[model samples]
Target: MFQNRHNLSERQVEILVGNLLRYGVLFSSALVLLGGVLYLIYHGKETPNYQIFRGEPPAFRSPEGVATSALSGRRRGIIQLGLLLLIATPVARVAFSLLAFMRQRDITYIILTLIVLTGLIISFIAG
Candidate 1:
């Protein structure tokens, strides 16, 4: 029984590592994308909108002074990080289970993928 289990463990590890590679791709990509977005937001160009709001409430003209650009950028950054986490977690789980699937050559990937897809779809619809 022990012998059989170890063989299973080794195969499972390989498949799991493969799946981790997928999530690693997503996170690294998201970081790169977010970085580009931040750069554009900060230094892309000037428009009429910016000029219009230049001396408005967000520019210390209002009662509750707030720097709209800075506040919005900070909030966007936090939301992006949260999005990264939401995507990365289950991908990690699927990666872990992939190890078991490789060892057993079973239906783990199919089930894991379906679960991921379902969650993603639900998120999209609800949001």
Candidate 2:
């Protein structure tokens, strides 16, 4: 006989998800703050030409570029990485929800969560 067939309660799972979101936000904020400080330290002395609006340098354009620059201690790339983390947090939450729904054996919710997860994946791929 399977002991405690009813494992995690819905409320417990909800609380776990809430904590995930809270911690994710906190971590992303910290990364952004650190990036901001680094940005100031690196660029504070540079004089910008306000008359002509300039775009970000080549190293900040794409994900690979950002990662490469970030590895090289570029603050803009660090900020981009932080923003990527912020973007990924909700996707991670959805992934966790999918697993939770599977564990609960709630068919309706499991299907619904799967659909949502699939949509998220498709959007990411299409983009």
**Which residue pairs overlap in candidate 2's backbone?**
none
Q: In angstroms, how far off is 115's CA in candidate 1?
A: 38
The window of 10 residues in a row where model 1 has the poorest summed lDDT is 56-65
The whole-model lDDT of each prediction reads 0.56, 0.84
- Candidate 1 Cα outliers beyond 4 Å, as residue runs: 1-3, 46-127
How many residue pairs clash (N, CA or C atoms closer than 3 angstroms) in each of the candidate models, in the order given?
4, 0
TM, every model? 0.33, 0.77
Candidate 2 Cα outliers beyond 4 Å, as residue runs = 1-8, 49-68
lDDT for each residue of candidate 1 in 1-127, tens digit (9 for 90 to 100): 3568767776667666666766666775675477557767775795446535343233433212323433465534433444455455665666556555554677867577667667765774575
TM-score of 2: 0.77
lDDT of 1: 0.56
Q: Residue-wise lDDT of candidate 2 within 1-110, one digit each (tens)?
A: 64464554777888889998889888888878899998998888999889998887887666788788778877877888788778788989999998988887889989
